[model samples]
Target: MNPTSPFDAERALSLARETLTIEADALLALRGQIDGAFVQAMQAMLDTRHRVIVMGMGKSGHVGRKIAATLASTGTPAFFVHPGEASHGDLGMVTPGDVVIAISNSGESDELNAILPPMRRLGITLVAMTGRPDSSLARHADFVLNTAVQKEACPLNLAPTASTIAQMAMGDALAVALLDARGFREHDFARSHPGGALGRKLLMHVRDLMRGGEQVPRVPADASFSATMREMTSKGLGATAVVDGDKVLGIFTDGDLRRMIETGADLRAMKAHQVMHPHPKLVRDDALAVEAADLMEQHRITSVLVVDAAGHLVGALNTNDLLRAKVI
Candidate 1:
């Protein structure tokens, strides 16, 4: 609050760097603080038969929400409940089997502390995430996660900058440990976040986006070269599969036609089998859509024929199909 000092760009930059440095140091210090207590807290959460309820007040509440969300998305079931609301019948949400994670920098937020005794009496496990291990909140807990920072990043040492970061980091640490213990995989994460890009890559199968039946551009092995070109043009997939009784024999593409014309080959007399590229790239109908994308990219091809377990042509898809579905 210097009234006489004017705005200086260098000062602004210096303060920003200082704040980041302080926060970074605080996070690094947290690594050493992770001891038996953290393990105990993780065990308490893992052993719980019900949800992990996160409770906090003020800035700590904001961090708690993110922590709860991260925990939920990563394989743990959790939700944030405001400490102030917990006193007014919201505490009823806490069942006997649930574990509660209470966040407070001072370990003595009046709103949060008010319900801790009742929660303990209700036979729910209490985990205190606090900067002060000796505070009342920590003393009443079944387990304590000490998130103490040496100092606040704020120049006045008043704002909850460094302290909040520590709390969030601690929450993430617990969540990740629990995730690893449960053998959580990307597919599991995708299940919780099905609307995200990773979900599309992991959950979407080739059969989900592939053109099946009549939509598939196909021609018989004995079909004339002109017939192949017509199939490609009509399907607009840039390629056509050569099949015999549903068994894929080969593939013909616009590139193949261009090459035939460039080499002065007789397009008029060629059959579909003669002009096609034999043993073309093929993806299984049950394969992940991202796997199809990888196959196409690796072979420098734009389209791939989809087949079932029996090696019979079931459908087809291309870069456009993947693009349309946002799979790629």
Candidate 2:
């Protein structure tokens, strides 16, 4: 590497601040540029029977890919197609009943413009996203989304820094607008992103993380205190449910054992029901795991019994179970 002069920290910080200010101002200006054309474009996309096709060149293409992804994940079917590739044979992907959003800063890209006429002939709805309203792309478009910026954030005023931010903002605006129009909910978004954190919170149920069958610590209501303590110790849940058949009658925990010992109670003479706490906090089996976490947090308890609609003790879960499931 070649040697360079000493770096000026103040100058670097000043430039970073100026770059952010320029981009912030550009977005502020773009906010006022929202008009009927944006609404028309959104309506076209919403009414399309097929997918929304996004096309762009250079930096705008990167923004186009993100726009398509956001739209697809938020209930609108969309994808990105490179303009240069469309000129070869990718243009065949454009069919009738689709909405095309072509993005360009100057709105005069040769590769993008070359395929515009053919896309028009195919009778697809064309929406032009550009800074120049009078460019070739806008002329052929059915609707125009103006993403004009006062100047580039680059020191030379050449690179697409502020312009790219404006494009991204516009794309997000459209995706959110369509999301609202479709009445899309969190579950819908989770369905598309099943591998994400939101999916685990929304899709996973208490039964999925609860200890069922033999894993549950339980004993009969008529069992001796020692047997109940043995059941609790063997299951390692620090607690045991006192059940009458499948019905949950009460619960006994290590805390109860300590309290009974402190009170000088006759421990060897106590039955399971005599020592257990009745009406313990319970969670439904089909409840969301996050809901179980909420129940534990709200009650300030470490564990809860899982029951069915008929109030039968089906399983049990503790803070450790929720922690292992990453629901806490």
Candidate 3:
């Protein structure tokens, strides 16, 4: 790579800053242009029984794809169909009751326009997102969202930069408004996204990875120290819940055993409740696994008790379980 001089580096940085400033101003202009048409477009999407089909050409098509994805992920059913492809055979993707969003910065893409007449004849609601309202696509649209920009970020003033940014921002705004209107909650979003780390954090409950039933290291309140140690060793969790039936009385970890030894206590005479930490940090079995992680981290402990709504010792979870579940 050729090393650049300080003057050249400064010029490059200045131009980059100029590009961002231009896009920022473009968004301000676009915000002022939001009128009754934006609301009508939003209402069309809300009222549609079928899905939303987004169409565009060139860079506008790229923006349209992201917009469609945003809408789909945020509780709105939407997809992008290339206008060029639509003209060939993908036109059937547009059906009655579906809303069509056609995007073109210039408001006139020949490929996009070629199929507009047929799409219009289908009686689908047509929404045009363009900078030029007088252009053919805008004129033919049932609703028009003006994405007018003063200029491009390109020094030559030719590339679709500011205009595209404005379109993307408007699309995001629409998606957020629709999301609010639908009362889409985080749990609803978690239901939609149930496969990644995000899904694990939002949907994975403590019971999902917790050791339950016989798997839980547990001993009766009257059990001997040796009995508690055996329970911990047998369960392989390095700890045991000192319980009375299903009700948790306290917790006895290896640390507690070490502390008892340090204190020179008569280990043979001590009961489970005598050496246990009372009212130990416990998590709900039904709570999100992420919440369990938070509790452990906050308390500086490696394991936690998972209890039921009635405060019964229902399960056990540790840092290792969290790692295996990919929730940490």
| Candidate 1 vs candidate 2, lDDT winner | 2
TM-score of structure candidate 1: 0.95
Clashing pairs in 1: none
In the range 1-328, model 1's lDDT, one tens digit per residue, is: 6899898999899989999999999999999988998898899888888999999999999999999999999999999999899999899889998999999999999999999888998899899999999999999998899999999989899999999999999998999999999899999999998889999999999999999999999999999987888999998989999999899999999888898899998899989999999999999999999999999999999999999999999999999899987888
Flag clash pairs in model 2.
none
**Candidate 3 Cα deviation (angstroms), residue 44:** 0.9
Estimate TM-scores for all models. 0.95, 0.95, 0.90
What is the RMSD, in Å, between candidate 2 and the native fold over all Cα? 1.7
lDDT, candidate 2, 1-328, per-residue tens: 4468788899999999999999999999999999999999999988888999999999999999999999999999999999999988999998898999999999999999999889998999999999999999999999999999999999999999999999999999999999999999999999998777898899999999999999999999899988998999999998999999989999999888899899999989989999999999999999999999999899888989999999999999999998887776
For residue 38, give model 3's deviation from the true position in Å.
Answer: 0.2
The clash numbers for all candidates, in the given order, read 0, 0, 0
RMSD of each: 1.6, 1.7, 2.8
- TM-score of the candidate numbered 2? 0.95
Candidate lDDT scores, in order, read: 0.93, 0.94, 0.92
Error of 3 at 255 (Å): 2.3
Question: Which stretches in model 1 have alpha-carbon errors above 4 Å?
Answer: 1-5
